[model samples]
Target: MFSTVYDVIVVGGGHAGAEAAAASANLGAKTLLITMNLQNIAQMSCNPAMGGIAKGQIVREIDALGGYSAIVTDKTAIQFKMLNKSKGPAMWSPRAQSDRMRFSETWRNMLEQTDNLDFYQEMVTGLLFEDDIIIGVKTALGIEIKSKTVIITAGTFLNGLIHIGNKTFGGGRAGESAATGITEDLVKKGFESGRMKTGTPPRVDSRSLDFSKMIEQPGDVNPEKFSYLKTTTALKEQRSCYMSYTSLDVHNLLREGFDRSPMFNGRIKSVGPRYCPSIEDKIDRFASKERHQIFVEPEGWNTIEIYVNGFSTSLPEDVQDKALRKVAGFENVKFLRYGYAIEYDYFPPTQLTKTLETKLITNLYFAGQINGTTGYEEAAAQGLIAGINAALKVQNKAPFVLKRNEAYIGVLIDDLIIKGTEEPYRMFTSRAEYRTLLRQDNADLRLTPMAYKLGLASKERMDRVVEKQEKTDLFVKFLKETSVKPEEINPILEANNSARISQSMKLFKIAARPQLNFNDIQKINSVASFITENNLDNEVIEQTEIHVKYAGYIEKEKNQADKLNRLENVPIPANFNYEKVKSLSIEARQKLTKIQPETISQASRISGVSPSDVSVLLVYMGR
Candidate 1:
């Protein structure tokens, strides 16, 4: 029997729930985490990987904000890669291939070690609400649990329906049962909900494959980690992944199952991820392409199971096996399980405020797939923000919100709340207009101080950030003050194909050339001695170099961000009635009224609201 009321109750135990529970408890709230299976905590349900492209930047941001995702990732990674190495620092992303089992176990251990947190294994059936305000949850056995605030991070589990070829079943995942009651109850309570579909590739026995026929994809020669914390261990030995291609023969073999494929036969009505489409969908969409790339990734260090990445399907088991055999290195492939598609219930994010709390219900918040978002990184970011805001609400403190220019987390939440997603939302670097200011290398610089003030990020983390900043500033100042003659600089510059300087110039100016780098400049005796005396780390030196190299672009982006922040400062009263404003367009009024945007800037971003509408609202606000 549940008697005492908790400060926060978090539902589901995937990436989002884990962070939510950790954040709420670490911030001094008594939190309870309820899940159907505790052993599957933070399970990498799809791929045994984290941090790709924009997702990588988000993980670092999470780490900087006192979230545990990046630390866990570093602890369990089997391979590390910094993607887009050829591109600028703003575009570089750190990714890792994790040992799936270790990833989950690490998360479980972390949750158990956290203070003010309790875990319960139960399927939350419904919410406990009083007059449109959520107070707690109800389990399947009808036991009532009370809480001041509740965060539902139920990922791909609510009313989940799985499809394998023509066969269908009620399940959240391959071996897990579907969760019910909550989605139905929420809909009855006037919350808008819809269905979304996502799928995973089949797992195959690694020994059955021919490695010689596939191309090897190795980890970075010099790898970097995700965590800003110093306690995490760096990877010493990394496993290699392989690349194979699906040929025309494989496509022809797959098309034979079109009649029974769940996707094509109309069994699945919901939309899947647009960017990471199923193989069958890919073949159909790009008929002109000769072959599709398949990434063969290992599941774990000890396990022989391999994930057939890029081969997601809902075709019959026989069709899946036969088609996989046609791939270059999978001539004798054996499947551990056939790939399947699952459709689950999600609420439109527009129904929620920027803090992730529902507009219709007080103390009720939604994160992860429940908010129509895809990817573990996206889910984790939402959970941290929601958890932080939930605790602040309980303390009667102002809600903590991040600006778009500050963190990718801000951009994600803003996009969801402002322009509600029709398809599952995934983050991309292109989404951030001021990406140069939002680079992965500088996530700690952007968010740690704010997080430290919130009591989520610790003093130690803040101190580390301060130390790094000070060292970087001194290094930059040194470069600007020190003059290097042509005799000292020409040898390095000429070797790097940079034009030789005619006279003595500041080292900062020469380092800014496209071909020259900090490492090359450090060859100067005085510069190397300065670095050694300061005991500066590679990251600090690198940060200083990037700042000087991209100074122009960085300042330009900052000015633009400042201009936008002006409109952001003009707050629109929460109780403002758009209908009373006679000059507003009908569509703008309707959208503005429905969204109830918190600021003039948010109102400007809404689809139907125009610049003229924003001007009218600004004038109405007496700006």
Candidate 2:
């Protein structure tokens, strides 16, 4: 083997690249990670937060699979909140406000410490392809490094262009140079590519704000960390965020810059995230609304810097200052950095397989922003799955595929590989049908054994998981076997706003009521004693509660997933000419032929492929 030939070579050390390199290296692959700037590895380019909604579940899933995102976030996190606490377990997500500087440093430190991982700070300008297969990368300095497999997680850096008002620049990020060569080369290779844009809100000095003028948003009383690793958080001491809103005055000032706005003036033809729109888009879309929420998030414990969320703008800096001043507490705010919009190149993910490997290039894979995803957590989850599959590929092992029923990661990949997003894809709870079985609290329960079998999860982690499962099983049995008399459980039932117990009932039966919870049962001294005697960890206790309470729904979703799985299992041969089937729509035939979906279920979900088209496909497949 050549001196520099590595088992895996990962380019662009952003969130996705960092996780991918770490996972591949941790799985015993001799991996080399290359990036333009090592100092910015894992930087929070947009927000100083780790997760939100379905994104948090992705972070937890990455952790369960032995990826480093959750571990780093937990270490540098300043404020932690479990979002959607009032909702069902399926809806619960753990998010953390992170120290931007510390988060990057933590990732650097972790990468430095990991075995079999090497780092190089340089820009990759091209890939070396021989006989239609990617053999390695060519750096800007004209260095050719060979590797068995290459994972590209370039984030928003590939052919990146920034737009601020009417001004435009060629840079990956603020003060950073954009990567060249790769996009032109890929396009020449017949890869279909498109432009997508995403924007970040400005950062302001927190010292200039008057706290009394804004509403304080506090962290969860008992903030939970993301990793299953035993790490203690300083519970009593927590940071507080403030909430403000954009007033009509602010909107009016922002409108003055509309004529010069890149998004409105047609400078940016790329589609931006619909859920996270620029201030100008909001004003134009919701013209009558008096105000929109603005979250004033702290950058770190020691820094006066704060991220102005929900106030993303691509207006001129002077215009941004004028509008921001109109917000109640930010009247005297000083800008630390101006917000701008970035446009980057991304291959529609349908160009890749469910394993994230490129369909055109053998042993070459893509992950993170390269696949048009938006958030750090989403990128990290993709990185982990990609890394695992890459390592398995090297070992000649069976491909590791997570079903949509098993994880949000699975759903995410399936969606990307099947539907191919035009805009930056983000995670949402509503996207997962089997969400009840994919709760954040039970990520380790759902994935640890698989990780252990893949040799990614540590034996110690597996042992702890097994112990937790045993305890959870025992506790679930207790709930099923133990019964309470009507006199014993009625008061507790009434307190939780549930129907009064009519007679003796099994603990599982009462806990299954939507209003009643296992915590209510725990409050009962007798039941509390039974739980304490089992010596269960809090995670197990929580998981067991969710399992018992949502057993019926979980089972139903599982069955639904199983029914879908039959179609998922029915493989459609690649290169099957949809045009041969005369009954299919011309549009359907073209889309089906282009996407070349591997299964009937996947073909059904693609845009423009209707129910009738799917039926035609099914008959053609002899299903």
Candidate 3:
């Protein structure tokens, strides 16, 4: 039924593929999004939520880059909270509980509204390759659609295996069929693939839960959102989650199913996510601990389904029910759905470049769980970057890539492409070295301009960014240029528990003190009042605060990053033979040859490579 050649073709319609298709189409590319089932587009298969820790930063960055994750999340969010508020700014993350149905619907609607995007419901069984470069995709019905660039984000559906206790079946998600043929074809075509596993918890009927026995988990008093755009509307009367604990009784019941558990019985061989372990694994690993926490989170505003957090398992259904009833507040819980583990085919991310394109196949990119990473935010970030690069390739323009210091997305992609993952990777604040400069508060400030230049960000977004920047610059300048009298500011400073100033000081200098804040200074300084009088938005205020509070650290980080970039800029020749370097260690040569790092800096960071090997490389490159 179709004969048009698309600029970009996106396989699978999960978070990654949806974002990729939207981005490419919005960038004026004729994009085609093909999936096994169109109704499952952007489904929250594992979790009914979005954003956490460093993943939240990625969502904001995607939003800043004109990707649709943030907007879609906001439109469908049922509950919102800013996590780690008591911690440092670098650790602060925004998380939201979404309406499962609404989230998928929002994505479908947005994709349909997009100008240059076309939708197709079909399984991509194979690829049409020309001289080692991907030229198009072959559908299950034997129709071939051509494209200049193809992004594969099949997620966990590619040869997916569902494990329930000792029984296994071919399925992507609960009730959804798995996609086959592509993995076997790719393997035959010389692509290296491996198996990875991930699991989800059961859904319980809310009516059967005993709320009086559980601890109430309320949302933040003043909630924030993931998107920088004004698309977020304040929720009316937010929902509250509850906390419960799994006791020894629960553990004993789960142990009864040990023999039948797929994880223990060797029925599932793929490595699951270490960070988010299954209930049985958690019990096994943490035997010393008396109890584990479980959260009862509502699936949506309208649904009666409650997600049983911290209870992910592949144990038998009878054992699952027996154990779940023993948990606090769930004595009468009814299992609306049983939990299970999913094993799927994933191409080790080491085979990908920073652009997410496979080294084995040109113009063939992979993202999401297919690349061995977990979480919707991580997938969407990859999808967006891959889409941008794919569109750029179609336009014959230079690829747009971000530095590690520039974004969390950059850090994530860099880690996957450089180090490669042995486990399902999840983003954390500690994973980033320059996290002080990668705060979520300023993600839009760091990325919007670049997106605008690439013609991905909208004009309205660019205008808002420009205005915010101008106002923040003015505020920062005012603080730097203005001087405050010691006598006038001392009382206000004392009220904030800050030391009294001995002499007059620049407003900027006083604001930079750890004990002082914009509000504290506003009480004594005129410039602070002027800033308030302008009625700037919260995002603008947040930027000014961060800029003033972290000036020293930011400056130091920038200098360090500049020095590192010098090494990054030192490009390595692709055809250079590491085996020729006789002075290099055997292990170093092997690693260098396998990774084929794009720069000397990347080569230096590989685990087995040594500094001496880098010296050999530098000497060989005549540096």
- Top candidate by lDDT: 1
TM-score of each: 0.99, 0.97, 0.97
lDDT of 1 by residue, 174-271 (tens): 88999999998799889899999999999999999999999999999988899988998679999999999999999999999999998998989998
Of 1 and 2, the candidate ahead on lDDT is 1
Candidate numbers, best lDDT first, in rank order? 1, 3, 2
Tens digits of per-residue lDDT for model 3, 256-322:
9999999998888889999999999999999987899998888888899999989999998889999
- Report the CA-based lDDT of candidate 1 relative to the real structure: 0.94
Q: Which prediction has the highest TM-score against the true structure?
A: 1
Tens-place lDDT per residue, model 2, 96-190, is 99889999999999899999998888999999898678889998778899988999999999899999998999988888999989888778878
Backbone clash pairs for candidate 1 read none
Q: Give residue 362's error in model 2 in angstroms.
A: 1.8
Task: Look at candidate 3 and tell me the lDDT of residue 325.
Answer: 92
